[model samples]
Target: MAKKKSGKQPIIGICALCKKESTLEESHIVPKFVFRYLNAHSFTGRIRTVAEPNRPLQDGKKLHLLCSDCEDLFNKDETLFSNKVFHPFKKNGFDGPVIYNGDWLNRFITSVNWRVLHQDLQKITTEQDNDKPLTPEILNTLSNAENVMRSYLLKERLNLDVLENHIILFNEEIMRELFSHPHAIIQGSAFGTPVIMNKDAMYVISNLVGILVITIIKKHPEEIWLNSFVSNESGEIPQSQHFDSPIVTELRKFEDFRQAYIEGISKNQLEKLQEKIRKDPDGFKNSETYKRIMMDRKLK
Candidate 1:
């Protein structure tokens, strides 16, 4: 009785939240320690990519797309939400709104809406020159919002009588305007979309830590403005609300943060972001969030 070493052959496919063909595992739509805490002050801590941002960015962007038992059930609700609410909201900088436990905020919003609906169906099957066609009604509203976030992450349960056509909303006031600007310029665009407006939502938008996470498959009236971060009747996400809107003023553009750092990267990383924007073109052209997006694009 001495012959037991049958490991490594688990790579079949189809387990995007127990759909069940089996064995997958390379997940991570937005949980590589939230891009290692948004590239912990990146000069080169990597992690940038609004398509490409001068290449060299990688804290995590995996996507064989889940099955190590659904990536160990979304790494146990992303390690109970990065050790209790994103490391105490980044060690207490955004200074307010932090009360949760609606079963750990519905298993951390069902593992961030099942990793932004499988990273928007793996960016429409790997961006084939993006004509963006993943549509059979956006794949049946992301497969019924991934079976209601996999029955609230494997049965913690919340069908709440058809959970209002599957609702979900979260916002952090662009993480309190990126902790009230600490010498701004942290644009590591990890995207996720599905918005079909007049109702049919799904927005993951965490350009590392500026959190958004919307979901609402089809039921509008802006979901009663996320009814105070829903989850009551003793579930508890009671207080914590600052997500004013207008998409946080288009994520405070500096020409969409220098076109998310010179789009799709590599012309030697767009000449190192055009030589760091020509050695700090006037400290990134005087940022009052780049003079209010150049006076709102010169009054449009």
Candidate 2:
């Protein structure tokens, strides 16, 4: 048996494809919508999808991770190496921000693991090969490859879809500038509410950042500290879930969250609302729901 390499030298285990973490978007190891059923309100007390590294979405969080490239290229069966991809260095060690993540050469070399890596390759090639079923011998070969390399899952493999509706890319600007091999943090908007660093929907950015974290790191100054923040911004969608939905026990009143939403509403209306709040804190404070939120915030 080959000895497994273990170290704390910042080598990316989760992120293995890209070099630039900045360019590398937060790839979800698991889908976010799945959490909706499990946790709809306040992250169910698990990672709340803050887009910031340290903050958890709500409470109980469960998700498998996926990088951007893996999600985009393979999830959709898109072809890699077809277009010119960027790299920080050709083969030598570098001083500036590297392009892709984690010893790409080494990753490819180490990816000889048959079960995980080979299966992906087979699944992908199978599509092109008329969806041919794997031969018993080949299937057997792919069944056991854990020993070869724990990090052997390749970006471009065959039929590699974990669950449908998987996300590929969450961000791009940072990915191209940073190496995706190291642990990273990303921020974006999902469904509606702001997210700073995300791991629930990263597949399109490429499997660059080994450790991808997404959250709505920064938003309007009024909606800071998060617990008061709402993940859903869509109001037109039927508002049926109760304040005490099983997924979220601590649901903020809809009225309290109105200012935070401006996507679908008119700008003039939003400005008027904002002006009202700014001009008359007392009037805003007098609202029954706002009073309740304040009381909760004080207690929480």
Tens-place lDDT per residue, model 2, 86-172, is: 121111212232122223322321221121243354344456345545455443433333222333344334322231111112223
Estimate the TM-score for candidate 2.
0.19
What lDDT score is found at residue 96 in candidate 1?
54
lDDT for model 2, please.
0.28
**What ranges in model 1 sit over 4 Å off?**
1-16, 22-28, 31-55, 58-60, 67-149, 153-157, 160-209, 212-227, 231-271, 274-276, 279-300
lDDT of 1 by residue, 91-208 (tens): 5633555455545555655566567766666666667334645566666666666666676776646553333221222233333343333124332234544454323543333443
Against the hidden reference, what TM-scores do the models get?
A: 0.30, 0.19
**Residue 285 Cα positional deviation in candidate 1, in Å, after optimal superposition:** 5.7
Residue 2 lDDT, candidate 1, scale 0-100: 95
Show where candidate 2 strays beyond 4 Å. Answer: 1-22, 41-67, 74-300
